[model samples]
Target chain A: MIDAARERIIDCDWHYQDSFKEVAAYMPEPWRTKYKHSNWDDAGVKQNLSSFFPTSTGDRQNYGKVVREHSNYPDEPEEPERVREGMDFLDIDVSLQISHLILAMGGVNADDKRVQAFTKGYVEYMLEEVLDPDDGVYGLAPMPYSDVEASLDILDRIEDEEAYVGACFVTAGASPPLGSRKYDPIYERCEDLDLPVVYHTGGSGLDEYVRAGYQEMIETHTLGFLESNMSQIVSVACQGIPEKYPDLDIVFMESGVTYIPGLISRLDEEYLKRPEEAPLLDTRPSEYITDFYFGTQPLEISARNELLELCFDMIGTDRLLYASDYPHWDFDSPSIINDLPMLDDDDRRAILAGNAEGVFGL
Target chain B: MSDGLVEVGPATEFEDGDHAIVEVGRAEVGVVRADGEFYALRNQCPHDGGPVCKGIVQRELLGEFTGTGERVEQYYGEECIISCPWHGWSFELETGTHIGDERIQLPMYDVVVEDGIVYVDTGE
Candidate 1:
């Protein structure tokens, strides 16, 4: 059933993390010595594996057992071969991949030469080696929010690359909000380049706003994405970023679609009360919201129909994009979305392909 | 006021201070009474699908027309407004309009009282 839409499918919200060794190479000298040496390595990898899955490692060959039983490669893949395997598993046609830290979840720092070096290196490597080689893969370039000028400089260089589709910004705990004057340069760059800004769920530097002792990674990951995206939508709408840059697009990656209806209505309400503030916009917040897109995975079945209807009602069919979040814990099977109850053929087609084509200019 | 009558509930069932969650066909409708008139609307709140009937009723300050006749500071009190339990998206029961945003309107169901019993048209 998905065969027809297979070529059209564009998974807009997958993630890729560099190997610890690869990531550590760009870390500053002292952090390299302290964090990398203590937390990761050949031996540390083995120890971590054993601790995570003690019972499964008892009788089998050490290296083979560790790789087979406890490896998160199935959970998180960095290698191209593993990524292909993940795509095959989820039946996804294409993936737009972004990194958690490389994209500034910790906040972009221009003075931090280490971050600049690491991000540039990662972006170049991913584009040239990983995504460019495969027709089915795309890359979202990293943005350094700490220094918008430098980030725009990098964007100007990467804008023409076929593998590069957009820029990924860390939404969780972003200082000065996404719509502030501080980000005008970045927004201006995106507007000029026609690159959508992508926001992913988790990484470093959000510990301040997040509560302490929140042990479950799932809760933290979910809350972080939802809260961050919600605030981003509000800030952008209230501050008239969408109005300022009418052609610029934003993609809320990893955040589920459940919260969207409320956010849209809330923004609409706020706009009504403060029309003088957004004199540039000709329509309500919901009208501008339709210009943006969202990627959904681990598909929310319970309220899928209602959410889809509401989003479609406000944003139209061109805004919803399909994604699989390949190799993640709650990874969605391609067929799972096909099995959702009561969706019509046209809506399904939009969710799978047509919307994505419009989003990525494919 | 118009002849848009449908059997909603017993008049006593929806008191001045309370609301009734009525199922008319597949649609869940919220029935609330304020200012001596009963109002009915689709039960689902625009924000996150919170149950509107379960939300607290409150009065809020809305912008009012100014003294200069320019409609500035348009502040008005909407009594018996239902605030969604999830994210607080409020709607005035009398108009089915979102409290602050006048553009988005909740689907309203017609209601009438007959022999001390009230009826609401589900519009399904």
Candidate 2:
């Protein structure tokens, strides 16, 4: 029952998250044991629930309105049928999956094997329930960054899967930068397999954002995702991810598009001042962003048309992919794209589908 | 005005895939030996004024991309490429042209070999 939504729109970012129990079914041994004891509703795993959150941001009256409108959001983020209804409402065609509860749930604490278990569990369930069942569904397998061998094992299994769009990670908490030699094997595998590496913020189970001087949930929520994307973008570009693995394409998800122009601009400046620090780079810092794609969700909208267009120009329309961070509190709708009066027909088409078609080989 | 000759080194000094920077008149030229031939280019990168001479040299890569629902890999030739150390702007060492943009190129210098020596005509 899709509304009169465009059939061509690919929701570049969406979630089909399953709980620990769902994941544990396919998980092996100790991790299966761990899931039995895991309590997702514990204060530790709670998202966007703070005693002072509603009090702090009440002036922003439209706050949480969209999530409120859709009763299924956040709670049923992983429910495929429920998700399909939202997609139909928005008229979204393909919705790419990037989950948080599996590999990253352990964050920096889980040892390698545990992380791998969580990942395997999540992907196995996804295969059984969502991706295998839905034609328009594509997913990025969650990677356990704690162990190289574990990550490789998952990739080996999924190498032939058409539903496997790629692999997803936030930045590893204390691991080497994404461009480090430690990750070369993974990049090499991705290169041969023809899957792009996808990174999104607020994963890794860390939720380390509360340490960033923002006490209220809104403040942490607002800047947390942005910081994760920003740091990795710098880490990879400056450290030579593109040069090292020329064939591997990377996509940054859910962080709004505004941060890209500034980060790349700063990187270009920093490279000019201290070229020795980043000897791996073969081109200007800005050029690496050309090899990458940015997801547009919680897409930026302001009265400032020129600045928004400036971002579109800076990254090129071909490099930006439309995303709806769907089923989350701040999910952007496919309908809002019609509101982007700054873009032309060609640019809109590219952002909506063409860019993704090229990026994911959709 | 003839910039005369900048003696890069003995031909043996640069094996295949070897590169060295030599002083040429008012500028420094990077001379690379690839596939039994010596090639030289100005050290200055046109993009962001990077030191193009002090970069990595490797075979031109034929990489993976979306085409016909599958990934493809095939190199154009055995062309050697030099990538700027600051950021990864790759230029074909033989032509000084960036792999993506033909117009964005490093200034090419002439390399001539006589006997067992490699010389760059830096055209001062």
Best candidate according to lDDT = 2
Candidate 1 residue-wise lDDT, A245-314, digit = tens: 8788877766666677778888778789987887767888777766778777645654548665665566
Among residues 3 or more apart in sequence or in different chains, the pairs in candidate 2 whose N, CA or C atoms overlap within 3 Å are A107-A204, A281-B87, A281-B88, A282-B87, A282-B88, A282-B89, A283-B87, A283-B88, A283-B89
lDDT of each: 0.64, 0.71
RMSD of each: 17.4, 26.2
Per-model TM-score (chain A alone): 0.80, 0.87
- lDDT at position A179, candidate 1: 79
In candidate 1, stretches whose alpha carbon ends up further than 4 angstroms from where it belongs are A1-7, A23-77, A107-111, A203-210, A213-219, B1-124
What DockQ does every candidate get? 0.01, 0.01
Model 2 chain A poorest 10 in a row by lDDT: A58-67
**True-structure RMSD for candidate 2:** 26.2
Off by over 4 Å in 2: A1-7, A37-71, A102-106, A172-174, A203-213, B1-124
Model 2 chain B scores worst on lDDT over the 10 consecutive residues at B45-54
lDDT tens readout by residue for model 2, A244-270: 788898998887888888888888998
